[model samples]
Target: MTETITRTTGSADVRGLSRWTAAVILPIGPAAVALLRYFLPYDTVDDSSTMTSKVMAEPGRMSLVLWLGFIALLTLVPAAYSVGRMTRRRAPLLTAIAMFLVVPGYLALPWLAGTDQLLWSGTEAGLDANTITRLAETPHPTVAVAGVFFVLGHVLGTILLGMAMWRSKVVARWAAVAVIVSQPIHFVAAVIIPNHTLDLIGWGLQAVGFAVVGWAILRLRNDDWDLPAVA
Candidate 1:
């Protein structure tokens, strides 16, 4: 009886942790990133010609942003795990596939960010512009392959995961739809407005969607905990 009670308590703890992770931390990464991209100091051309000089001008601020970005990427693991868990009961295969894609996609984000930071730091250390440009333009074949994986994983995985969540009915239907359409809407708005308005829409959608998911988790009864384990 004691052993059974202990096991039950452990399972409950896991469920609680997973729920909080999904509802709270999951949304922070994308929202923070969107804010960073749109905000002052960190704001600039996506791949500007003057990157070296920019890095030299504000090395401290750039370094802080880089570390913050890394922290944001770290939140993806728990977010993905909770998402997989919530959808597994209704769409096991889809959830598993989404996890496979998204895990690598998020993992690659920090690596890419870190790589960029290192290049900029190197420039600050008097590295030649030609060498930096060449390196950025011609990444290793493996890095290039990883970049492809990163892009596909995020784009395709989010769609699949959002659909799975919709089918699972784990969150509000509108919230699921918001998650599904956020990226495309953001992309379109970015090209059209080319301003912070895109960031507001992009991050707002994510915040609302994740908040709904979290609210739903908070409402879960003990009976709901009998669902399939997250693979």
Candidate 2:
């Protein structure tokens, strides 16, 4: 009977992880690809396309992608809290809230991506003189919406991630601190530099988060935190 229980629990762990992989981890890479398309180093920002005008042109659905991509970060930091909790006695509510935020945010991501395609297509095709002026006259409403949400999700997520570090102590206290501190470092940069390097940060951070989350999850699997099955 003990052996049977162990086997059953093991099976459950595998299943739970599989679901997590689909819902959270798997989407990170693809979503990043979708987001970086417009923001990368050499990405086109037409001389003709002013800050406001450029954003207004297409605005079809890229925000969805960016949002989803940002959602990965949202999921990532909380995931750290979850990891830290593995070794801690106190439960981490921040991580749980972060996890819960993932679904709605992710669901909204693809639509934003679509909007991007539409907006870009308009820009690449070139707008009429009047259209260009209109684009620049005031901030495009959609751009503001996307930008605010993107920043909010990420900045908050990083804080949550840092807190997880404080809680988990897995990557060592200093390293965890660095992870959390990186957010503020980058944020300061946004003000100092020509623009936010959020895309770059997103790309770079994804690889790191992937490795960290994978390691933590592996450890969880070994320990059978949920006690799914005995291995």
Candidate No. with top lDDT? 1
Candidate 2 error regions (>4 Å): 1-49, 52-91, 97-115, 124-126, 129-147, 195-210, 222-231
- Per-model TM against the reference: 0.76, 0.55
lDDT, model 1: 0.67
Worst 10 residues of 2 by lDDT: 40-49
C-alpha lDDT of residue 229 in model 1:
37
- Top candidate on TM-score is 1
Error of 2 at 207 (Å): 4.3
Q: Model 1 segments beyond 4 Å from truth?
A: 1-18, 39-48, 186-200, 226-231
TM-score of candidate 1 against the unseen true structure: 0.76
Model 2, 69-173: lDDT tens digits are: 565544544343344444344436755654444333434444445444444544556656456445444444765465555455555655565566567555455
The digit string of per-residue lDDT tens for model 1 on 1-231 reads 353222333233465555555678767766666655554243333453355556656677677667667766877667767777778989998898988997888787755675567666776778776666556665556676677777677667877888888989999899888777766665555544556567567756765676677677767763475443332
Distance from true location, Cα of 4 in model 1, Å: 10
